[model samples]
Target chain A: MSDLSVDLGFLKLKNPILAASGTFGYGLEFEPFLDLNRLGGFVVKGLYYGPREGNPPPRLVETPSGLINAIGLQGIGVEAFIAKVLPKLQALDTAVIVNVCGASEEEYVRVVEALDAEEGIAACEINISCPNVNKDGACPAFSPESTRAVVREVKRASRRPVIVKLSPNVTNIVEIALAAQEAGADAIALVNTFLAMAIDVETRRPKLGNVLGGLSGPAIKPIALRMVYQVASRVKVPVIGMGGIWSGADVLEFMIAGARAVQVGTANLVDPDACLRILGEVEDFCRRKGIERLEDIIATVKT
Target chain B: MFKDPEARIVGKESWGDYFLLTFDSPAVSALARPGQFLMIKVSDEPYPLLRRPLGIHSRKDKTLGVFFKVAGIGTALLARKTPGETLDLLGPLGKGFNIDPCLAGKPVLAVGGGRGIAPLYFLAWELRALGASIKILYGGRTQADLPLADKLRAEGFDFACSTDDGTVGRRGLVTELMEDEIKAGGGSPPALVCACGPDPMLQAVALIARDKRLPAELSLESRMGCGFGACWGCVQRIRRDGKAEWIKICEDGPVFPAESVVWEKESP
Candidate 1:
């Protein structure tokens, strides 16, 4: 059997397939369907400084090969996550990472501080790409400078490794990735949903309650791959690539594009078993290619 | 917990605008309980990236039945499926009706509106086999929508129906038909009321259950992302123990105690 394990510098994974945050809830809900210990690891839904009620109803819309949602990062806050969720997640045999979102720089650092001393958390995936909530009407991930500032602060405060979740909405994503890497980010998770919107011509109403949402699915795969290639080539830190990854080939493509590991996002929504299934498919591909380990092909791209 | 397995289509039957799909899926069928649902991948294509949630209609041995209406691109694709074609389905997800907690010698009241009546058929069928008294109240916008009327009658079920246009059964809301049934029972109704349908109608029924202090349960619907608890995209405001919490409709329930639902914040 081909070795699917990979050491991502800051974190070691049994495999390279991690369930994306927001798509995996707090990780307990999928205990029935998902054997958490069997996979690489799972990231829980994004958390905030306080409980967020989220956007109004009709927060989701489906596009051709994609889904756009404005869930607005509704979470139980950092404290509650540590109290009610972490204890159980700590028992899992896989990585238990928390995706934290904030409305401001201070909010972001505060959450990092809370998780810094917390136990069982493998790392903190600082979210700055949420389209639902913006501070001063600007999404932090949109500006490379803002992205660097937030990552630097969180990296300084965080006891564990920090992964700065980047946005696909930016024009020059490479610059943003470089900024985060220079700011002391241990790693970077690319393409946190593309900013998009849908409309209902019949009622002339926006499909999502928050008007716009992050678009993810097969529709964004090509775009995400391009961005991953761009950022991975420029940034020194390990890259966590995610976007419309539905197949084993897609996972392999992301890794060859220079991602140390990949997160299965929208595919999990289509099939909760997508992660494991994709992992199986990856193993099959590696076996057929006569490759012994994923590291052999990890970012081994050719002209 | 859920499983994604390829289920072969056994048959497809149409009742007006509704399509009743039967799949020869033993595992999902065996695990089936009324009020439980499955996420059906309508097509192999990528455009409609998410699965459509459909409640189980029947489980005759290893065959599973799903009754649904064509409401969007996903359902439209589902309606086009032919017998012998295979479908990838993830199911028997979500918390179904906890009938055991309320079954104690009390009869069951199953209320539904249009396709909302779909899941209730299986629910009533189960209770009937247990020798429990079952009364079904099926409602719709008009006669064209109440196609399940004759089928419910043919099953030897106690049927009470209403149509908004007064073209069939009683005229007015389903809550009125339920009130009439309650009056016919001499003010002592069934032990439990289980309902499914559009939000407005379910809310109205929930209000009646509240006013009468009748123990009721409802199968709620929301535009779902993942038909599991992960996304928390399909959430409903519910009041429990005097506190309000947003419960994921796909996980916490497609079925919840009727009184627990708070229709005030209808949008969230």
Candidate 2:
């Protein structure tokens, strides 16, 4: 079998396929669908300092080849996650990455510091990119300065590798990516979700209760690829890419575009076992092409 | 375990804008209960990217059925599917109608409003199997909409129906029909009420349940991103412990007690 493992410098992943945050819940929700150990890792839903109720109804709307969602980062808080979810996750053989979120830089540090004492957490993907919440311009991923500030704080508080998740709704994605890396982020995950929205023509009101949401799915794959390619070309840290990955071919495209690993986001909603299926496809492609290792193909995109 | 099976479509039936497609999947059919639903990937393509959530209509042996209305691009794609084709289905998901054994030999009522009637048929069948005397209140916009009325009759189910245009059974809303039954009986109301339908219809049913002191369970509808709890896409405002919270409808319920439902406020 062609080797599908990936190393992001700080830690080694059995494979490049990961279940993205928000889409994968707390990972335990999928225990009945697939073996968690089979995946490289899965990022749990974004957790703040305390439990949040998230947004109101009409949180999701499907567009052409995409889904716009404003789930507002509802979660069970860092304490509950450590108390309830971590024990079950520790029993499993998979890497459990925490997607940390906060209303402020202090909250982010607090969450990371709390998680520092936890054992099962493999890494912390700082979720400064979610567009569904942080309406007060608090989304750190929107600006390089704020991105650097939060990533620096989180990296300091986190004992595990810190992965900075970036947003595409910015003027300069590469600049923001570089900022995260400079802040000592062990890795960078790009293209969280493009800011988008939909409308009900009959009622003339926004389809999402939040009026605007982050769009993810097959529709945004090409744009996400371009961003990952651009950012990976410059940033020194390993780049983790995601945004609308549906199949194994899609994951391969991200890797080829310079992403060391790819996270399957919206596809998880389409099929709970999408990661396994995509991983199989990657394996088949590798074997068919006589490629022995996935690392040999990272950033192999022809100029 | 929740299974995502590529279930082969074994049967198909159509009536204008409505259709019923049956698929053979032991995983889903075995675990499926009344009021549960399935999220079907309508097309291999991504234009209609999200899976369409359809209520489980029937379950016999290893086959399951989904009754749906071609309301949008997703359902339209699903309607074009023919027998022998396959559908990617993720189910038997969400909390279904609670079927307590005490319901046996008791008066049970099932209500459906148009396509909302999808899950009620399976509910009626299950209730009847438990020796409960089942009565179904089915309604739609016109005669063409109440396509399952004859099917329900053929199965020897006791039912009543209504349409807005007076094309069928009663000449008004199904809620009106329910009110008439309660008043005309001049006796104890049904022991339990199970309903699936448009929000307004469900709201009316909840109201009826409230006034008559009858226990009611409602199967709600939402535009779901995933039929499983992972997406957090489908949520409903529900009251629990005297406080209303946004509950994930895909997991916590597609079925909820009528009293817990926080209905939309009627326009002034």
Candidate maximizing lDDT: 2
Please report how far candidate 2 places residue B146 from its true position, in Å: 0.5
How does each model score on TM-score? Answer: 0.93, 0.97
Instruction: Provide the TM-score, chain A, model 1.
Output: 0.97
- lDDT tens string, model 1, A184-255? 989999889878888999999998778878888888999999999888888888999999899999999999
Query: What residue runs in model 1 are displaced by over 4 Å at the alpha carbon?
Result: A135-137, B100-107, B264-268
| lDDT against the true structure, each candidate | 0.86, 0.90
Q: After superposition, how far is residue A188 of candidate 1 from its true place, in Å?
A: 1.4
How far is A208's C-alpha from truth in model 2 (Å)?
Answer: 0.8
lDDT of 1 by residue, B1-268 (tens): 4575679998889976789989888878888899999989987867677788999999898998999888888899989999999888888988898767447456778889889988898998888876778999988889988877888899899898899999999998887898888778875677888999998889878887787788889999777888877787888888999998777898789999988888854522
- Model 2 lDDT, full chain set: 0.90
Candidate 2: the clashing residue pairs are A217-A244
What is the per-residue lDDT of model 2 for residues B109-131, given as tens digits with 9 covering 90 to 100? 89899999899999999999999
DockQ for every model, please. 0.68, 0.81
What digit string (tens of lDDT, one per residue) describes model 2 on residues A36-70?
99999999999999999998879999988888999
